[model samples]
Target chain A: MESVSFPPLSRVAICGGTHGNEMTGVYMVREMQKQKMDKTGSLSVSIILSNPRAVEACRRYIETDLNRCFTSDLLSSPVTDSTPYELKRAQELNAQVGPKGSEEAVDLLIDIHNTTSNMGLCFIFYSIDWVTLHILKYIQSKMTSVDIRAIQLDLPISEAYSLESVGKHGFAIEVGPQPNGVLRADIYNMVKEAVDHIFSWLQEFNSGSTFEGGEVEVYTLVKSVDYPRDAVTGEITAAIHCQLQDNDFKLLQRGDPIFLSFSGETVKYDDEELYPFFVNECAYYEKKIAFHLGRKIKLTFPSINLTG
Target chain B: MESVSFPPLSRVAICGGTHGNEMTGVYMVREMQKQKMDKTGSLSVSIILSNPRAVEACRRYIETDLNRCFTSDLLSSPVTDSTPYELKRAQELNAQVGPKGSEEAVDLLIDIHNTTSNMGLCFIFYSIDWVTLHILKYIQSKMTSVDIRAIQLDLPISEAYSLESVGKHGFAIEVGPQPNGVLRADIYNMVKEAVDHIFSWLQEFNSGSTFEGGEVEVYTLVKSVDYPRDAVTGEITAAIHCQLQDNDFKLLQRGDPIFLSFSGETVKYDDEELYPFFVNECAYYEKKIAFHLGRKIKLTFPSINLTG
Candidate 1:
């Protein structure tokens, strides 16, 4: 209700549980606070336990991936027709945090996450700028286990992405490979370490100007993914990201062949299957191949552009 | 016709005529290119010449300042009623360069600009984050004359702005009081210094993570001096650094009185003599002062409520 309540002298934000399946970071922040890792000066930690509904229901976001829906365009939709409640929570929390988009003033964000691949005990991705350089050095001194990459996030490079789309210079530390108990503890320890790292460095590091964040290297815009649906039984697959990218007929083309039924019994294409219709030879570009030829780069899918 | 094109290995962007009067940066880029300032492989400078029509017609963009028109809501209708050409040009350039909102590859953009500061010598705005840290340090170590800041941008920090709207991360280097060859030379020197700094560093730095560029120290935003039509005429006589706190009004509230125009006959907020108003109150905010309030904290405009 208060428009501008006095900001705590120092604030720390640990946001997680966007996807019910990824609640490790959520509980970790809570447990970290529960364990009393915050002892430094006036440092207050705020945790946004997003998606209470999904967390209660034990689902990843019922309708959508919470991470992909934070853009300005998608966030502008007033109606919550098919929008998952988690995103609405993000929007509301965003409103509470500060102004949307450019006016947001997030000092430091430690978005805790867990990746599918069990690589890099934890990876700290950031733009390789000078502020980040000192941050990297300072953080590396604190965290010897985390893998940090200072990538140039521009052309001929991967697009850049912020941790939670909060639009500040933040990084997501992936805990482990799954939504298991052990992974949660790994995430908890990392967060505790991160908080300490921030506290120590921030207390002494005052030489630089304010921290301005970086551009995205590669865009992780996994807009939409198709799930397998049973026709007669009407049962949806319990898992995602597994069968989504396999030889599933969901990504059929205008003229490409489509095999129906898990046993490969039915055969169809543009005229037969009821999903992923390609209008032209350049229609289907969802996850199509984008490569280079002699002198030009070409993008091709079932029906989206045969030539560059 | 291409959505995004980077055929040139290096790019140099020049945005001029933002004020319709300051066209020095525009001509300097063109001249520098004629002299072959654009280098490939190590550095690619993309030139974004702004307000081509304003440059030719010789008038500041009226109705709406092109620089202030980069808001998300206004992207569709960048300019209103008048300044059709300016709007159209903006659209074309954005189309070519593509929106910064896209998670696609981007190139180095050095916007050339000229200012009418009856104050100090020329300065170059160094973007913050990873890349900018190097740029700033190198600029300081290499180019000693230019002043720099690492202000959080008013526009979306992630969304790169056109010259007209290169937010707080970017700087508006004021050359010698305009209308003099010295102003033109200052613009050239600044651009050349930036280009040179980037080139020298690229040899050693090669590339860095986009998000991890550098940190900034002193940051500031451009607070426009809004006025009524008939209230004030030429010659901005207000002393600089007078400090106007935009606390009372909403972020973009129009007709907010900012300055008092004095012309002997009548001192007015605008030439039209409309109702006097100023965003002096920022009523919604509990804390309204601009200076540091004791604790080691930074002011992220529009206070974020830690607790709901």
Candidate 2:
């Protein structure tokens, strides 16, 4: 692979509270704003608390999910009196830090999130951009205290829906095992450390330093598995089995127990073996995702230096 | 102490969805209803979903906390169009299973709940009624797979503000470490087994068996600790410290680290040693409770037989 050259990264935005109940990002962005962290070395940073109404209500969103409101189609959609609050907020956020697919968008957007799943610390991004990949590599190297992994959402730029998709180079730094509406010191610290490392990597990158790249493992999303439901009532009939609970990122065998029905019957996985992530996430209960299956593959990147 | 005599427990009610996001109880009550389990030996069982609106929305409650809406004052208050949905539901529930202080109330009410805390299989009740205490002992003896404990609220029967207080002899079976809006197979099973044991105990007592005198460990309500907050903003500045997180029912010594601030400072407990439970419950975050402090004690109950 040829070394890719890109313009020097400058404007960066750090967003939080996209999902109101996720306290880690909510507090992190607040703490950063409190400290007036506008400039970190060469990069100018903007601290944003997304979806204020949702954050005020301590809900995932007041209307539709704000994280899913950022696709090019939705962002450009005309607003009206009856428009969902999240969709309106999405346009406002895009206007502030991005005009999607434009050169004026922020150089990098690091949106922080916390999941109820025991995913440790993960980077979720759309497409495989070298800049985001190198940052993930840098953070993984620096933050040796916990496991660092990435989930690549295979989607076109125009179709990318998350808040992070608004930036030139963006990814969500998701750290968890923390429940919604509750915060844990360990989980909070892990996020803080990851954010600090991100800033450090930006400084090193902007300082005209050549970066050596190597193979980094990434989990490409395969498909989501919904909980077994009663055909008549549409209520879930079983729960994630004890064997699979909190076992995110573990490869699922064809015969492994995935769900335990209320009638004391075990429902085994009968699909091709794949790693599971977001296993038993709290918010996904409404979305019908018991967990998401992914294929793990290693990607190699080339060394790159910033263009003048 | 002499053995106490009580009327035969003929009518029993099992309530779920009190805090609608607590899925263990929601599913248990639904399952019991699906099986049409209305009769068990000498007892007539009623499966009730206490907060249907909240359950349908999958929220803790629509207007207010339903679990706190069951006091005599709230139950007997005149209904108005503006009254909170939970208060109205509480009154309706009282009419069906309780008229609470009246003789027509159900004999026993087993309200099931799930907490985000690590408290495993706990019984929470008001007053230290002999009937409820004996039932706790029965459950503890039968369910040896998990630690079974009890929390005494120390409130008058008239002042008790919970669905369980609606019955003549009732207590909430709280099992967890399970997050709200999530159902865990282990937690669901624990709640199911505990409910089954309650029925078995009831059947044996109804058959003229005397419960043996024994001492059971209880955590009496002491006080609640809020997360350290910023005075100006009233937002929490700290989270439950790593040392104290998930260590529910563990004795907290004076000077123990109870909170870790966002700036990396540890806030130590400055009060008397106490046992902590409901540590980091998700729903209580809005109620401003980081965790609850309690005093551990052993209550000894005398043998009691049902009077014909």
Poorest stretch of ten by lDDT in candidate 2 chain A: A175-184
Backbone clashes for every candidate come to 70, 0
What does candidate 2's lDDT look like per residue over B168-222, in tens digits?
9899988888877888888888888888888888888888998878888899999
TM-score of each model, paired residue for residue: 0.33, 0.98
Error of 1 at B261 (Å): 9.6
Model 1, B166: alpha-carbon shift in Å? Answer: 8.3
Per-residue lDDT value at A100 in model 1 = 34
Runs of candidate 2 with Cα error greater than 4 angstroms are none
Task: Please list the Cα RMSD from the true structure of every candidate, rounded to 1 decimal place.
Answer: 29.2, 1.2
lDDT of 1 by residue, B87-203 (tens): 566565555554534433233444444432322233333233333444555565676655443333344543433442332223344443232111223344455556556556544
lDDT of 2 by residue, A1-308 (tens): 87877788889999999999898999999999988899878989999999788889888999899999999999999998999999999999999999878999999998989898889999999989999999889988888879999999999999999999999999998888887887888888888988888888888888888899788999999999999999998999999999999999999999999999888899999999999999999899889899999999999998877896
Residue A73 CA displacement from its true place in model 1, Å: 64
Best by DockQ: 2
